[model samples]
Target: MLKTLQTIVVAGALLFAGQCFAVDMTGKVVEVLDGDTLTFESNDGRLFRVRLKEVDAPEPGQTFGRQATQFVETLLKGKSVRVKISSVDRYDRAIAVLILPDGRVLNRELVSHGLAWHYRVHFPVDPALRALEYQAWKQNAGLWVDPSVVPPWEFRREKGARKPPPADPSAMDYNGIFDYGLIGNPDTKLFLWPDCQGYPEDSRGFAVFGSELHAQKSGFKQSPGCSRPES
Candidate 1:
């Protein structure tokens, strides 16, 4: 039993060491570029653009995009933080996990609050981050309130194929009834515009909305996947 316990302890230590980051550094956040990206200034005045590893936030044009940025700014802007650098990306940004002064993990916090997505493509194996996202979704927190919420990666890919988004998306007719009408999911309490990628062809059990306001009045929220074009 003693020998078995010793072996288990040794294995655990090695596993932890394997998960350790390549570099650890302390810095103050100078600027919040977005939800998951920030400018970090070292004590000696050196600057590095740091990206939160395994986290992706909504784009500036997407729904809740500004909120995610505001969330990070509220928590870390101008505050000192410790970062564990895992690797440097091609864009010259350090992929890291930012640790707040109060010991909260910034990456995990973002996902837990539904302000960011767990970047599974880049760092796919973090079960904690995955579970946090699921919990946020289950609770309908932040962006999760939009039942058809688009992942940042998917949003980016879709955006790349289209013309530039308008300067003021709010000016678009969200409540206006278009020719194709709206697709709604009664179970999720979300309504998607006809052009939305998540709109289903089989609308058997789904509810229909005449306009955005009609859906809202009926206790349904608009999905981020439904980016209404300018009327």
Candidate 2:
């Protein structure tokens, strides 16, 4: 029994180590470029432009854009943070999750405070962040106070519609059938209706289920966004 327990403990330790990410470095935030982007300087005098992963705050043209920047600037500028570098984005920004001085994850905090969005394009939606965002919406916090609030993603999309050509019939070959169900946020272990407010973006991916039975057999539970039976 003792040998078996030791083996189990060693296996667990290895599993945990495999799951842990190596933080590239720690730094002092020197600039707040926007709600989701910033500049930081490491102790060794290296500077890096870092983007807060999984949080997409508004652009300056959108409503509450200034407020979002201000919120991030107030909390992050001149603060000590640890950077868990994930990957470098196309723009050459270091994709990272910042652990702030308060021991809170900055990405989650911005979404929690209604100052930013839970971006699904780069990462899966965290359920706690989803719930916090929902609560902020329910309480009419910040951007949520705007009843006609268009999400940043939607707002950006609409910006392109200001002057647009009519859809070509040839390019409009999309089928009229709507036979798709979603298994959203592999991290949150939840599924969402495609139209749900917190639906994961296509970049993060949604496994389309042609039938509900497929969704069930694949171990995805229906989220509240859908009217499917919760069983």
Which one wins on TM-score? 1
Candidate 1 lDDT trough over 10 residues, lowest sum: 171-180
Native-vs-model 2 lDDT?
A: 0.65
| Model 1 TM-score on a 0 to 1 scale | 0.60
The sequence of per-residue lDDT tens digits that candidate 2 reaches over residues 120-167 is 552245667767776876777887665545567656756823323225
lDDT of 2 at 13: 47
Show model 2 residue runs off by greater than 4 Å.
1-21, 122-124, 160-231
Estimated TM-score for each candidate: 0.60, 0.59
Q: For model 2, state the Cα shift of residue 74 in Å.
A: 1.1
Cα deviation at 85, candidate 2, in Å, is 1.5
User: Candidate 1: where is the Cα deviation over 4 Å?
Assistant: 1-21, 160-231
